[model samples]
Target chain A: MEAKLKYYLQIADNALILSHRLSEYCSKGPFLEEDLANTNVALDLIGLAESMYIEVARQENEGRTGDDIVYRRKETDFLNVILVEMPNDDFAHIMVRQFFTDVFHQQFFSELRNSKDEFLMGIAHKSIKEVLYHLKRSSEWMFRLGKGTVEAQEKAQVAINKYWKYTHEFFLENDTDSEMLKAGIGVDLSLIKKNWLAKVEEIFTMSNLTIPTNDFTIEGGKQGYHSENLGYILTEMQFLPSKYPDAIW
Target chain B: MNITALSKEELLVEFEAKINAEQKIEPLDWMPDEYRNHLIRQISQHAHSEIIGMQPEGNWITRAPSLRSKKILLAKIQDEAGHGLYLYSAAETLGVTREQYIQWLHEGKAKYSSVFNSPALNWADMGAIGWLVDGAAITNQVSLQKTSYGPYARAMVRICKEESFHQRQGYEIMWKMMEGTKDQQEMAQDALNRWWWPSLMMFGPHDSDSPRTGNAMRWKIKRETNDYLREKFINKTIPQAELIGLKIPDNNLVLLEDGTYKSGDINWDDFWKNVNGNGPCNEQRLAHHIKAHTEGAWVRESAFVSGFQK
Candidate 1:
């Protein structure tokens, strides 16, 4: 695969997978308003992913469509980081996961808004507003979960510890990243990493939460590798289309 | 004299006069206790139906065959949740809090539309629900737009506007399927068959059999009878289905002298069974809601804690 295509898939897959996970909370939210809010975010992310997939399909110039890329791809073919594929075991974990990605998306999309590729730059430009709102919501939840009560604080810390390992994958530099950066079509993850870390630290400090330093990390999803959880998610998401591939939905 | 200072008979006279004049009864307006209680029951039940309605459709959100379908379904579910809240707010004007309304649902002290107790076993059921179920609901709600209660009538107007799109999307799904492979067409037909009777049952019961609606009708809380709305829905929906080349699943359905299609007899036994909570998914729906609420208790509690308030 070319550098631009791989880069597009990476960002698109991240939004798609994360949005899929979030949609699982549609009716199961902590409250009615929160449920509606989460689904709205999910809808935004899906829209983001769709735009990227449309670009991918256009570049490939194949007969396959954006929906085809989503429905026909195998679990291992997905390029999202494992952080997004992690289960929402509880409200704390859901918020922690969202907070981490929202922080990354905030800086990443802001810098990507300057990409040499006009299409990608437009996507980033339109998407930055959504990412900022997502960041605000997740950050507010982090404070509530981390500073609310002893039990709430404990749960939030546990989620932070569990998901902290996957954060490094966001900054993983590969050949595609290097090439895309050289062409000015991609933002520097290392630069985004610096800003992401600062934001995380600021939120964590205000929330009175501990930041873990043990650097065990998970990777490889960007290269079409993922956790077992991705398999289950894809199974359900792809079931109907896989069952009746010839039918138009 | 103050409104509340008036004698009970005077208040009833005033309330009845407002009904006669088609005046909206606001939250602070003096109403009879019977009217308030009835409105609470009806509106809260409507709210609960919207909330429980999320489950069957949410079932299809993950597997919604296409990106457009998935987005539509998710947005529709979100809208349903919003509708639920709107209704809850409207019912609260009658002195019932949302939490209390929810408790009634959880404890079986209240009831929602029993149509949801039927399982959505196929992808085509999504289309069926959007088409048939929403089609039936919109017919009733369009009439509800004229209800005497101010908040509920306004909520109905808002809901009816958004609801038509839901029915159209559902019909589009069915039409697309009917235009697809043999298997796809069969799937659509099967969904229609399963959902046909239940959709009819959504009107509660025939006007002749529903003795309890007298008070509701007299107050204009319900502007149309159950039978009239069901017939209106049938009359409107038949041509749409015929245009799509889909069957109505009613063998005895016939075009009458008035040009309205009259469907076959509904299974009242089954209707009563579902209403009494013996339907296929009754326990599951209530259990799922209770579980979500119970599990989310700590999260709700966190918002009230001193640290969170700080």
Candidate 2:
């Protein structure tokens, strides 16, 4: 596969995987408004993912299609980060995970707008507008919970600690990403990492929270390997398409 | 008057002045305690309505006939939820915490819209809700954007922006049915028949009988009387029904001499019965709500453990 395709897959896979996770809250959120807001966000993510996949297939020029990349790809062939795949577990966990991912996504896309790759730059420009909204939303919750009550504060702290290790992988790039970076087809994730840290640190300070320092990082997602959660997700997401095998409505 | 009695009258006068001046009452503003109490009750009840409103439409999600239908239904339900959150937050601004408001609901102390207490019954109920229930809500909310309360009005503005498509989506569904098989058309009419009267009741009791109407109006909380709003909704929807080639539920629905449609009498007994927790799905709705809340405990716990709660 072309390095640009691989990079686009990572972007598409992040949206696809995270949106699937968020969609679990569709009927199940604690309140109705959140149910709608989360699902809207999920839909936006899925729509963005589809757009990215279309670009990838077009760029690859190897007889690939969006459906081929989406439904036909195996779990190991997907390249979403581990943080995007984690379960919500609760409102706080969801917020924490959303906060971290959004911070990285926002900064990554901000820089990717200047990418030498035209299609990638266009995608980044659009996706960044959405990522900015997501970051603001998650940051608002962070402030609300942190400043609201002792219980909220304690819970938010716990959620951050548990998800902290996954933050590192967002910046962990290998040879492929590096090659794309040199070609100006990929963003230097390191810049995104620095921006993410600063952004998160500021939110933490305002929320009266502390940042945890831990070096452990899970790196499998960028390599097409995933946690067990992906199995269940694919089963449900792909069930209808696979069964119909050319169904249209 | 003595100190206590004088203060009460003074508070009422101040509240009236603010309302007359068209100023929004914020959380920390000074006014009659009764005004605060009344708004808390009304706004929280509205909040509850949005939450419970999810059930009827939620029933049809997995069973939505087409992917487009499914997506639209999901989005509508989500919008309902978002409206609920905004209402809850708005209510919270009135000194009622989210937990307290929820407790009131679980204990049957707070009332949701009586309309939602009934079952969705069939797929057409989804259309009916969008066409009627949401239409009624929009009428009420459009007026409420001018309400005296700052947070509630501001939240309603945001909600109304997103809710623009809900009623249209429902109407679209009905239109589709109108163009589909005979069975589908009948299903649409049947849903409309069942849902029509209940939707009018969503505006609450007749103005004459309503206890809060005078004060709510004085406070700009209710911009129009229930009867008047009901008449407006009927006038607007009746033509829509005509365009869609579906009959309105009531044969008595007719244009008045002065260019308004007057609706038939609603079944108030049924409305009150549902309001009092005797509706078909009242228990089911509450049970599901409590179940979902409890089931998500571990997730909340994990969030707490992860410091995300902070």
Candidate 3:
């Protein structure tokens, strides 16, 4: 039971953090259409997190609300991988990070749809539709950036190099993941990784970009370890709610 | 179409007759130069306001208290962006390119609403801006739905419908805060106090003093005077504030037997100052947009190049 809850937290934490990152680009998109599209994805990711966290609150049965789970948790307890917390240094960096995650999620959610837990399966069923659209958008953006102009292609290359090292953490499983896999409650990250790489390679071929050869990887999200980024994200995200603990927004 | 072959005086007479008869004027209609320029200026400025207005509300999107709040604010800003697009498209019908309109905004030759020039200072400023700022803008826009120009009026109809929800969402925030702790109540009241005067400033100057109103009203481009709309906003909004237990922040305010709230004099000095490019956030708002525009140039260029290659 405890491993199942952590399984949900792992996914929720990633979506919630990434949603915040995308929301930062609300009015700052490269164009009006892109601005709307970026924020639309931000809204969808928050909805994804909302569903998962609501289930987390329900199963915990501690009289805790979804808001409490999101707002009251300390920095060290969040389980999102380091990649989603990466800064949106520019549009190139933003799209590369999104493409990496979307490719992974496209496989992860499709696998989760086969989970023994029906409610979790329902979430995956719903989320896979959104993930499909997300994958299409990010892949199109990757192709555009990789083939667009000389300078744009250079920026895209820099961004991919910066974020490629963190993608390995997506498949890093810990005790909770293993336990959930044994119970048939969560996804098999190894299978997700193979599919992620194939789709990525296919897109890169059309994008005229190269996959990074260096495979230096680090992993700590399962232990609630994070980079310096999550703290700043939590501080800004939790400001108003944290100020007045009794307040309801 | 045949109106173009008529003499200038005859065309003017026909245009006035159409406006007087409440008939729609199509894009091909032979309107005067002054009329065409007025619609271009008004529509583009409105579009610029929608674009720049995103800044004040957008700051709170990341900091929104919950998933629901975050989604609502995000969707609202996206609608503002959509509104900007619609207005720009409508203005383009008058033969101006969207690029030229954006250039005018960047060069400071175009002016948006003065209300956005002030900073959104607090969390409750979100509520205040939606309730007060959007509320006031809606009051003016509701009348604009019946404006004489076809495209501008139709655009107003769509924008006003979306705008109604924003004001209510804002009022909902204020009501929830008013029901919260003392600090929250203080925040809500503070937002109201700061935003109230600026919202009144949104309605523009009184009819007698407005130079633009002369031609704008005579042509039905402006359906109502500025003072009339300001009074309507004050009358409708004060009761909402009082209902939510917020003070109106106007010492000289009065309530008439006719159930209207007569506001004190607007701070026209500040209004004029902001109009003349000297507000607290006028430079910041425009610069934020210019920076985004500048940064986005490469993305646009790349899309154009790759688009042609395809």
Q: What is the interface RMSD of each candidate, in Å?
A: 1.3, 6.3, 0.9
Q: Per-prediction count of colliding residue pairs?
A: 0, 20, 0
Report fnat, model 2: 0.16
RMSD of 1: 1.3
lDDT of 2 at B93: 80
Q: What fraction of the real A-B contacts shows up in model 3?
A: 0.73
Which ranges in model 2 have alpha carbons more than 4 Å from their true place?
A: A1-10, A26-44, A53-86, A91-116, A129-249, B1-36, B51-99, B118-128, B145-162, B169-197, B206-223, B245-269, B287-310
Return the top candidate by DockQ.
3
Tell me chain A's TM-score in each of the predictions.
0.98, 0.95, 0.98
TM per candidate comes to 0.98, 0.67, 0.97
Each candidate: RMSD to true structure? 1.3, 6.5, 1.5
Tens digit of per-residue lDDT, candidate 2, span B64-128: 54435656777777777777888888888877799888888878888888888778876678888
Specify the CAPRI tier of model 3: medium
Mark the 10 consecutive residues where model 1 chain B has the least summed lDDT.
B301-310
Candidate 3, residue B224: Cα displacement in angstroms equals: 1.2
Off by over 4 Å in 1: B1-4, B306-308
User: Which residue pairs in candidate 3 have backbone atoms (N, alpha carbon, C) closer than 3 angstroms, thus clashing?
Assistant: none
Best by TM-score: 1
Q: Give a tens-digit lDDT track for model 1, residues B97-197.
A: 89999999999999999999999998889999999999999999999999999999999999999899999989999999899988999999999999989
lDDT per residue for candidate 2 within A116-199, as digits (tens), equals 988888888888888888888888778876766677778789999988988888888877789989998888887788888999
